[model samples]
Structure formats: structure tokens, C-alpha cells
Target chain A: MVDDEADLAEAIGKALRREGYAVDVVHTASEALEITVYTPYDLISLDLTLPDGDGRTICRTIRAEHEHQPRILMLTARDDIEERVAGLDDGADDYLVKPFALPELFARVRTLLRRDADVAIGAELEIAGLRLDTAAHRVVWKEAEIDLTAKEFSLLRFFMTNADDVHSQEQLLEHVWDAAADPFTNTVRVTVGTLRRKLTAATGLQWIETVIGAGYRFVKEPVPG
Target chain B: MGRIRLPSFAETIRFRLSLAFAVVVFAVGAAAIAGVFLYENSTLVEPVIMAEKKIVRDLATGELTEVSVIFPEESQRVMAEKVELDAYRRALNSLRTSSFLALGILFLAAFGSGWFLSGWALKPVRSMTAVAQGITGSDLGRRIGMTGPRDEMRDMGDTFDSMLDRLEVAFDDQRRFVAEASHELRNPLAVARTNLELALQGGDDEEIRTAAAIAYDAATRMSGMVDELLDQARESLPVNASETVDLGDLARSVVQDFRASARQRGLRLEVRADPVEVTGDRLALRRAAVNLVSNAIRLAPEHSTVTVSVAKAEDGRAQLAVEDVGPGLTPDQRTRVFDRFWQGEGQEGRGAGLGLAIVKRIAERHGGTAEVVPAGDGSRFVITI
Candidate 1:
């Protein structure tokens, strides 16, 4: 979340964090750009006006520089049609006017993320016999429903979306954790460990496997037996 | 589709001017020609005497002597002069007919030239009308910009352009004021809304408390902004300015009201009053005094005195002023001190910035003036009626 209004930015950041999304808040365009240089966000909530620079220019810079362009959701106090159209024309995926309800903002963020990950809205992610309903944040192993914390659910969602790929701890931190997380910490490993235990305990099979020298990957399917 | 109708010719200035021209020209020409014809006719009717040389027999002389005789015979002289009179009468009748004929032709020629000349002369007015009609509140930049030798019509066009210049500036200021007001309103509104949403989302007690506090602050800010907006609107309204308001009483009341607030800020409220009366709206005058005192209290340093004074000026006008010993305004700030939404340096988020502007409006509505009085130690504001 990027906004010159510090209070609004913090509130939105807290709400997004509660929704199981790792959210970082910044009050200026300079800080927003500085953070984006290191972290590859899937979607960005951008306020149209910032202290250091205009949000549209920041949006354009992000679009031009970032190899993996984050989906930008513009938040502006101006509700004029021309501003909205210009925002979208400048590469904003969506926009919300100021004084918008939290639920509406959350919905837009979720939609943008889903679109970014190429996941169907409200669709359940299934790999082998493990099924995850992203919208409800529910996990099901065969017929038994599994409960997960917000962080664990987010990690599982990321894994299920990229079912057969290896992601390093640093890579996981960049995508799954906000910028506030320590780079040299073991949080990502611990989270992956806990997530693995939960999946194994429920299905009697190890879903996440760590290669000898590579990062962990989620298996697309378990052995037939 | 509606039927097209042409403009009425008689109603146009061109047609009216042309008709007047034709009438004047025809009248003058006919009068001069008729005078000349009348004089010629009067001279032509008189009989001319003739002398004839003829052989006549002298009664007293037997021999016939040749003699010139004057024709005194009335019948023969009438016969001889009758042909000349007839010719002169024929020439006078032709002169009368042809003089009138020339006058009639001159009237037609004058009317045609007058119509064209009037139309040519009104071209600038037509352009000015077109330019005026094209202007609206949203689009104010169009100018007549008449380029010609300075004349009445050109002068009018230049005056119109200058008026539009002033109007455009005023309109731009109004638009900027509205935009700033909305922006100000939106900030607090967004803060309150987001915080309330967070608080209602069933967070922990500490988080909820924080959100509630932030939301409360936002609500207060928004209410303050709304109050200032309301005050501005009310001050701008036309009110009866015939009431005899005592300036001293108004200042004393304002000082009394702000006494506690001023003390809380560690500022002293001093009122020096002499009975002075001004004709204006009592409520508006009181509001202006209150605004000045409150601003002084807000800006003055701790332990400083804020003097509220009301008295009759040397010029016999009533004056009410508030002076504070704090940071004095710069030269630039002093000039724009009463402009809408103008805040002091380093006081970005102080108030809505409409208090001084409202005071100025009230002063003007009462046929008075509000001004910033320069001081060595601090700043002062005065309203004179």
C-alpha cells in the first residue's frame, strides 16, 4: 500500500495483512519505488497522489522498469471520469476512489491478485488429492477438511498455484512476506516446515520435497501406491 | 425544423439611420430648389414695356415726318407681351417639375448609401456581440481583441476585454477554492472512514482503541471543516446592514468569550474599549471580532498579550482591531492575508483557512473594510466601518 496519508496507508496495510496477504505500507513515492526495486510484488495498491511524486509517474516507472510488472490498483481522491480513464491508460489495472469501503478495496485487491496469478475467481486449487479453496481459505485432504493459519494458507496458495516449481527461501520471502520481514531469517523455512507437516498429517504423504541443493517444490501428484 | 425568419428592418439601427439620412437630405434639397423657383416665377409675371418705330401722320404738321412712338395701346401691348409671358411660365413650370424630380432621385441615393454606411459602422458592434454571446462561465477566455483606430466601439471592446480578464481571474480563484475545499474535506473523510472500518472489524482491544482514537480525531477535523464552510457561506449572504452595532460592546463580548481559551494557551486577553457605533449587521460584526481574537490567541506566543480594541477613528469611522505579539507576517503574506484559504508559513494544517476570509467578507458586506495592520512586534487585524 502506497499513500501520502500515513493513517490511511497503515489502516489498509493492517486490513490486507489480516486477509492473509503480506502487505507493505509506504508514505512516499520514493520509498515505494525503493522497495519495489528489491521486492517483486504480485499486485500493488497505489495512491494517486504522493509527497515525492505523482502516483501515475510511479506507475509508469514500475511498468517500464520491473520485468515482472505488478498489477497496479490506483486509489485516488479524484472521482472524475477523466482522471480514472487517465489512470487506467497509464497502466493501472483498476482504481478506487477515496473514502471507499474496506470490503470494496479488499475485493479489488483480491481480484487483481487472482488475475495476476491467472487463477479463476473463487476457484479451488487442486493438486493430486489436496484441494484448497482460496476464497474461503480452506484446505481439504480427501474428505477431511484442514484448518490453516492465514500465513500457512497464503503459503499453500502460492505453492498450489506454482505446483511443480522450486522457490528459494529468499524468493519465498520476497513473494509471501512483506518488506518488513528479515532477509536472513528462517521464517520462510519454518513456515514451509509447518505447512509440510500439516499436509503430511492430513494425507499421509509428503507433498513438499526439498531437493539436495535446490529449494522446495510441491509435487503435482503422489506416487500411485 | 422551425421556419427561418429574417430580422425586422425597421428595428435595426442601420435602417433607422438610413431613413433619417434620406429624409433630411430630401427635405433640404427640395427647400432650396423651391425657393429659387418661387423667386424666378415672381419676377417672370411682370409685364415688360416695348418702344416701336413707326410712320405716323402728325396732326399738327401737314408734311409726314418719321417718328418713334411708344406703344401705349393696352390691347396691342398685351398681345405683344402675352407670348413672352407664356414662354417664361413654361420655363418656370419645367424648372419646378425637374427640381422635384432631382430631389426625389437624391433621396433614393442617400438612403442607399446610408444603409451601407451604417452597416459598415456597426461591424465592430456585431463582432462584440458575437464574442459576448460565445462566452459562458466555463469558457471565459474568449476576447473581442478589437484592433482598430481608437473609437467608441473600439473603446467598448477594450473595456469588455479587460472586464473579462478580471472575471476570468475571479472565476479561477473560485474554482481553486472549491477544489481545495473538497480536497480538505476528502482527507478527513477518508481517514475517518478507514479507521472506523478497521475498528469495526473486531480487532484486539489495543488496535481497536487506536483506531477509535484516530477515527475520533478525523471526525473532529471533518466537523471543524464543515463548520468553517458553513460560516463562510453564512457570511457571504446578504444581510440587513442598518442595525446600529456598538463596536466596543462587540469587542468586549468577543474578548469575554475567548478569555478562557486564551488563558489556556497562556495568552492574556486585553480589551480597550470606547463607545463606538457602526451601522452594520450586529451578528456579522461580532463574528468578525471573534475570528480576529481567536486567530490572535492561536498564533501568539505564550505569555503574550492579545489586545482587542474598539474605538472611533480620527476620521470618525468605527474601528475594531485585534493585535498579538507573535510572529509578524511577511510583506507578501500581509497582502494576501485576507484571501481565501491562505495560511501562514509553517501553519499548514492549522485550521480551514477560512476565518480571515470570512471576516473580510463580513466587513465588505457591511460596507466596511478589513485590513492587516503592520506591527514591529507582531501582527494586527482591523475592521473599519
Candidate 2:
């Protein structure tokens, strides 16, 4: 992890280390660049603005130097979606905005790491009192197993995978259902409504948030009923 | 005791200009009146006075000896002419006073006309002053719509209005940024707080691990947000990094980075760039290019190809274009695509919809432009420097 904030770096380091990932922490951009240059880390949690240089630059330098570049998860105070997209463009595998829930961070890291199938093929996605097993395609919410249709499960996975970020119905349809734009389809909304009802019934936690004229925003940490 | 009315002499452009006009009028009017008075005195009065004296001298010796005191031809004539000369002298004195009076009237007229003309010519300037004075950070809508014959005063007003236009645009971008920043800042902090609390109130190791992992993510996000905010703070300054950046190399490097993600999404990110160099900030240019690519990737379909090309335009401007064959943008979307936080239908959660805005800013900073060039399949984002 590359961060200037001591307490935040320590806390995040401790949390990720518990997930069986060997993590290293750096306080300055220089140290980050130095460590990244030498060590082949699995992932680098970078702060965009650093004491020495910009995190985006560091991300670029890493991508330039390393043949097998480690996945980069950008952490920044920039909450703009364009900044996030730009971060990804700058070689960051994922991005999270400031003061975000640890659960959301976990989800992002897990998603990035999961991209490397060799390392994380069947890792479980855990959101307080809720767990998703990718290999078994099973969900246990509040210690109770809930039946889900394949489409519903796919939709839930997408929402869970990208927790705390809003996703439009079109985007949801594109990612979850591999079909191109069919302007007449309301399948995404119907599926989401069913998933929200089922999840709420079982876990007693409301997780899906609808943004008007936008799309659905999934809660990083489940909201208690 | 009465209230004292104090004069306010300010260095305002309007006051200075009006004073200048009044002074010029006074100088020209005074000179004209003085010339007329001097010419009239020399031509009409001086010769007449001299001839009258000569006649008096002639009468004093020869004609006076043979004169009858009763008839008194030479003496009476000389005396009457003397009274007439006195009258002429009084008339001359009156002319001199009248010239002074005319000068005094001219001074007042010059000053009044100068003040009136300056005010009339500077109506736009006064409006500009009001706008400049009344404008604050929040209110950027004031304008000096000067309409008149094309003159310097009108030009200044137009220039001032254009300047305000630029300012309003810049402020609009920053203002929207601040609003979005506030809303976004809360989410990550809330995320971190909740996860930390969950970790603190954990019952099982799995719960603690999940909570801690999430908390870590949030902290990372928060620090990154701070970084982004700092970057925006520094964005007001022009890009001072002057380097020989090879546009082709920059495009290639970006393409190489996104190669994996493109493949993962079953989309192709192709770079057809020629070796081109432009003097600019590398980081900024790279970001501009990256925003284009990222936007294309987001909007493009799974099987569609996203092309990022760098070449020289006909005008010798180094150009970068990112084209994607996806659901094409409508006229409305194209218009507002660069507006801050403008997420068109189904465009939310895409980095606050600021990709195009940043690209435009970066392009502008490089003394260039970013716009959409109509493409065959979908939309093409073009940045020319």
C-alpha cells in the first residue's frame, strides 16, 4: 500500500494482511516508486496525490517498467467518476474514493485480485453478515441460505462486486447479461427489484439504492433493517 | 452644523477618461478664442488709433492759428474726434473683456460637453464597472452588453465581456467540482467509519477480516480523494511543463497499459499513431489521452473496437482521436458531454462524468482544444494541440 497518512496506511495494511495477502506499506511517493521498482507486489494500493509525486504518475511508471505489472487500486479524494475512469486509464486496476467503507475497499481489491485467476479464482465476497461463494454460486445472508435465479445471482454478483458505485441499467445489462442495447427491454430493473426484495427478505438489510435519473448504487456495508 | 459632502475622486477608468476629454476641449476652445481676439484687435482698432493721432498733430500748429474761436473748425473737430477716440478705446476695452468672457464661457461649455460626451461614449464602461464591482464568486452572470458604433470604448467593453465569459466558464467548472467533491467526500468517510465500527464490534475472524479490508479500502479512497482535490486546486494555473513529448509514444504506452483491460472486456484498444512531438506537459497530455480511452471503453460494446490514433492534422496540429463503435451520442449528449458532472442517460457512476471535462481542460491548458469529430460508427473524441 502507498499512502502518506500513517494511521490510514497502518489500518488498511492490518485489514488486508488479515485476508492472507502479504502487504507492504509506504508513506511517501518516492518510497512507493522505490519499493515498486524492486519488489514484485501482487497489488499496490496507491494514493493519487502523494508527498513526493502524483499517484497517477507512479501508476504510469509502474506500468511502464514492469512487464507483469501488479494490479493498482487507486485511493483518492476525487469522487468524480471521470477521475476514477482516468485512474483506470492511468494503469490502476480499480479505484475507491475517500472515506469509503472498508467493505467497499475489500470488494474492489477482491475484484482486482480476482482478475488474476491464478491467485484468486474462488475467493468469497463478504459483506457484513452476508457471504458469496463464487465457486459454489451460493449466498448466505444473515446465516440463512436464499434461493436465487441464475440471472438474479449474476445481477447480485455484479452489484456486490462493484459495491458502493452506481451502475445504470444499461451497464448492468451489458456486464451481467452479455447482450447489447435493446432499447425496449426492462429486464434489468425487474431483476434488480426481485433481487432487492429477496435479499431484503432474507438478510433484513436494504443494500440497493436507486439514484434518480441515474442508476442503482449498492451499499458497501449492508444497512441494518 | 451641517453634513459635509465630500468629493470622491477615484482612479476609475471612467472618471480618468472623462477628465481627459474635458481638458482637451478646454485647451482647443481657449486657443481658438484667444486667436480671434488678437486678430480683431490688430486689424480693426490699432490703425484707427494711429490715424486719429496724426490728424490731431496736424491741427495743433497750422490750422489752429487762423481759426475763429466761435467757428473753431480744427479745435472743435480735434476735440470731437478725441471724444470719438475715447469711445473707440472704451469699445476696445469692452471687446477685451468680452473676449475674456467668451473664454470663460468656452471653458464651461468645453467642460460640460466633455463630461457629457465621455459619459455617453463610456456607457459600456460604466456597465463594465458595475459588473466588475457587483460580481462575486457565486454570481458570474453579469454582462456588459455594449452595443454601439465600433470604437475603442466598445472594444474594451467587448473584451471585458469576453473575459467574463471565460471566467464564468472556469468558475462553473470549479463550482461544480466543489459540489461533487462534497457529496463524494462523505461516502468514502462513511464507508470507512462503518467498517471500522463493524470491525470493532466483530464477533468472528471472518467478520473482522472483511471489516478491516473494507476499512482499508475506504482509507485508501479518502487519501486518494484528497490527492485529486489537491490536483484540482492546482489546475487553475497553466501547464508550465514544457517538454518534447512524443505523441506516438504516449499513445503507445497508454495502449499497452489498457491492452489487458481491453482484452478482458472482449474489446480491442488499437493505437495507430505516427511519431509526433508537441511541446506540452506530459502528465497532462497523457491524462487527456487516457480519459478519452477510458470513456471509449466505458461506452463501447463488448465486441466493438476502440481506436486511439495520434497524427498531425492538416493545420500541423498534433491530434489524438479516440473512436468507438458503440451506441452513438445524440446531439444533446454531444453538446453537454464536456460539462462537469453531466452524466447523460445511463452515464452515472462513471467518475462523476468528468472525463470529457478534464480532457477539455487539459487540452485548453496545452493551448489546444478537445471536441467530438463525427465518426462513422459511433462518437470520436478529438484533441488537437
Candidate 3:
């Protein structure tokens, strides 16, 4: 559990610990990033507005560094649809607004954990000509090995899971960052462009399509070899 | 004897009522004068004629010489002349006195009748004026009661009452909307604050980063909800200006945007158009179309299809239809599908339940209507403009 409020962080940590999950509480975004390098957490709860940097950037950094990312649930008081969409787009598994019932928070946390467990167990997911081997963390295009960074791999994995779907930048951030980040940040685009370049260089095919005024899409449209 | 105000109570009533009263009085007074004039003329002329007859009778009988002849004292001839003169004078005096009295009485009666009748007739108008004065912005609900027989006043009161009813309902809805909006907004603000407070307290880099991530997500969702609500509110208002909008293009664009979200859920979103056009506000119409498409995306099941088609109906009205291969609504659900906060059973997680209601309001604003009908094993929403 991480929050600027000591009381809230402590309270949330105790609640999680009571539920049989080991919990660690952090205060600032910068400190939270530092701790992730040493501790392997099962789940993370994030708030968007922070004293240091925004939570979205932290989500991006986490996705970039972590091998097995923890399940993330965003807690916020913002009830706007765009914010919710942006949170989901950022890479957060789920979101709960502030003043929310504790039972609801617990339920969402459980749901994310269950989903993370399922994702951990699933070995491979295939879409069109693209294949992702979760166990190996590798991508193959028509049996050709494609080298990718951790962020690229995660982005590709998210796209494959939701193939032919247009995701807004905010949505990409939410999914990539565990929905605990700012969607307004352009980090998703830079990362996507980089990932697209790598994928294109390796496979000589532009698999990821940009849907203008929307986000990005992974359609099965074949590029000329 | 006090200084009277110009157009005092009596004068105002007299001005309004005196015309008809004066006409009646004049006709009656003229007839009375004519009758009295005729009666006095006959009475005075008859006595004079009787005296003339007595004199003529004496003269014809040669009872006395023409001049200086001894005439009998108190004779019928001598007496007839003297009485004739007195009778003429008395008749003139009596006629003048009675005519003056009659005129005076008629004038007084006319003024009194005019004042009383005008006051009686204007009572309803005065009450109406009072009610009108009370119907300000803060007191729009008050209505004037007719309080009389079924006539023009009743019609006026009924009309006023109906107008007040509509205004009251409109004001009440506005208040409820504002309250709901404020309540919804409070949630996100609280979350953002909590996140900021936690970030400042100092934690491990990972924990801090995670907290930051969660906070960002919350802020984004809150902003989106607020934007959507504001957009809906704006579109629901009646457009003050109108322009020709290409319904086909608008429908296609909205669908194109949602295509990806639909595909992600394994749902196919298709748009078909026939170059339909309508006169309306472009932004408002687009919002309405987007709302419908969004709703379809939410309601359609995974691995199903949502189709949006725009065309002209047989009646030359522009029509747009969004069809989804999802569980359709029941009869009861369809009845209030467009009512605010009307959520169907099993639709708790779908949305805020304001989509259809906003769409309906927009449609009405544009002189159009939205209806949900069963279509192809699911539901189809048709908007005609």
C-alpha cells in the first residue's frame, strides 16, 4: 500500500496484512519507485496525485523494470469517465474512487489478484501471425525471433491480448502501468513508437496500426515483405 | 371637500362604465322630457281654449258693446281672460321644475351604476394582476384561481396553472441534476488528495511509485466522467442555432472511434450510411450519435456485433439506428429506458445510466425522438431527426 497520508497507508497496509497478504507501505512516488527495486510485491495500490512526480510516470517505470509486475489497483476520488478511461488505459488493472466502501476495495483487490494469478499461469497467447510466449517473455513472428525490451514486450503482450482493438494513449498507460498513472502523459506514445520501430525492424512488418484521434491498434493486416 | 386625485377611484370607474350608463340614461331622459313637454303643452292649451270658448260665446250673443260698454263684474267673459293668463304661467313653471328634478336624478343614477358595475367586472382582472405580480423567479409555482363560473377567467387560470406546472418541474429537475453532479465529483477529488498526502509522507521507491500510479489513474477517470457529464448537459439544451449536418458522416466517425474498443471485446462494429442529411446543430447531433454508439458498445456481448446505420426514413426524416447483439430490454425496461437514473436489472456495472436519458433529451431538443425496438435477436435504438 502506498499513499501520502501516513494514517491511510498504515490502515490500508494493516487491512491487506489482515487479509493474509504481506504488505509494504510507501509515501511518495520517488520512494515508492526506489522500494520496488528491492521488494517483490504481490499487489500495489496507487493514487494519481502525488507530492513528488505523478503516479503515471511511476507506473511506466515499474512496467519497464519489473519482470513479473504486481497487480495494481488505482484509488481515486475522480469519477470522470475520461479519468477512468485514462486510468484503465495507463495499465491499471482496476480503479476505485475515493470515499469508496472498504468492502468494495477488498473485492477489487481480490479480483486483480485472481486475474494476475491467471495471467501468471497462462503460458502463451497468440493473435494473427504474432505469437507471445509468456514463459520465455519472447515474441515470434512466423517463427522468426524478435528482440524486444521489457517495455516493448509488455506493450506487445497487451496488444495481442486485445488484438484489433484501438486503445487510447490513456488506456495504454493504464494497462501498461497498472492503471495507476496519468493518461495525459505522452509516455505511452514514445514507448509505443519505440516498440513499433523495434517490431518493424525485426519482422519487416508494421503490425501495430495507429488510429488517429484514438490510440493504437494491433490488426492482422499484412504488410508487404 | 378633500383634494381629490386625478382619475380617482370614482373617476376611473366612471370613465369605464359611464359610456354605456350615459347612453341608457340619455335615452330614458329624452323620452321623459318628451312626455312631460307634451303633457304640459296639452294641459296649458286646453284651459286657454276653454276660456277662449266662453269669451267667444258671450261676444257672439252680443251681451256687451265692443268698447266702454258696462260689463258685469265677475262675469264668465271677464273671469275667463284672467284665468287663462295664470294657467299659462303656472304650467310653464311646473314643467321647468319637474324636468330639472328628473335630469338631476338621472345623472346621479348614471354615475352610481357606472361606478358599481365597473368595479364588479374588474375584480377578476385585479386578482389576475396580483397573481402575475407574485410569479417571479423565486415564486413560479403560485397560480391564480379562477374562483368564478366557467368562462374566460377559468380558461386563463388553467393556462397559467399548466405553465407554472411545467416551470416547476423543469426547475426541480435542474436542481436534482446539479446535486447529483456535485456528489459524483466529490469522489475523485478526495482520492486525488489522499494520494498527494501519501506521496509526501515518504515511502520506499516502489511503494511511492505505485501510489503515484494509482493516483494518476483516479484523476484521469474523474476528469473523464466530469467531461462526459458536462458534454451531456450542454447537448441536452435546446440549440439556439441550427445548420445542415451530414448524418451519415457523423455516424461513421463515431463508430470508427469505437471500433477498437469493440474489437478488443471481440465485437465487430460496423457503420452503414446512405448520405442522409438533416438540419440541426452539428455538435449536438454528433454527441447524440456518440452516446448511442457508446451505449451499444457497453450493452453488446463479447464476440457479438454492433451495427450503426444512417439513412432517411420513408417520411423524409433522417434516421440513425444502433443495433447490438446483446440481451434486449423487457417491455417494462423499454418503457423508461430514457428516464434519468433508470438502470435495467443486471446493468449495475455497465455505466452511470445517463446515456440514454441524455440521448433522449438531445433528440427532443433537436425536434427528434429516440426509441428502442427489438431487432435481430437483440435491441436496436432508432433516432429520427
Q: In TM-score terms, which candidate is top?
A: 1
Residue A106, model 3, lDDT: 64
The segments of candidate 1 whose C-alpha lies over 4 angstroms from its true place after superposition are A3-7, A26-74, A78-96, A101-166, A179-225, B1-7, B46-77, B91-101, B194-220, B233-251, B262-289, B295-350, B356-385
Give the CA lDDT, 0 to 100, for residue B203 in model 2.
Answer: 36
Clashes per candidate, residues 3 or more apart or on different chains: 0, 27, 73
User: Which is the leading candidate under DockQ?
Assistant: 1
Q: Model 2, residue A141: what's the lDDT?
A: 74
Q: Identify the superior model by TM-score, candidate 1 or candidate 2.
A: 1
Give the Å error, residue A113, model 1: 4.9
Candidate 1, CAPRI quality class derived from DockQ? acceptable
DockQ of prediction 3: 0.08
Q: 1 or 3: which has the higher DockQ?
A: 1
| Worst ten in a row by lDDT for model 3 chain B | B47-56
CA-only RMSD, every prediction:
7.4, 19.6, 22.9
The DockQ of predicted model 1 stands at: 0.44
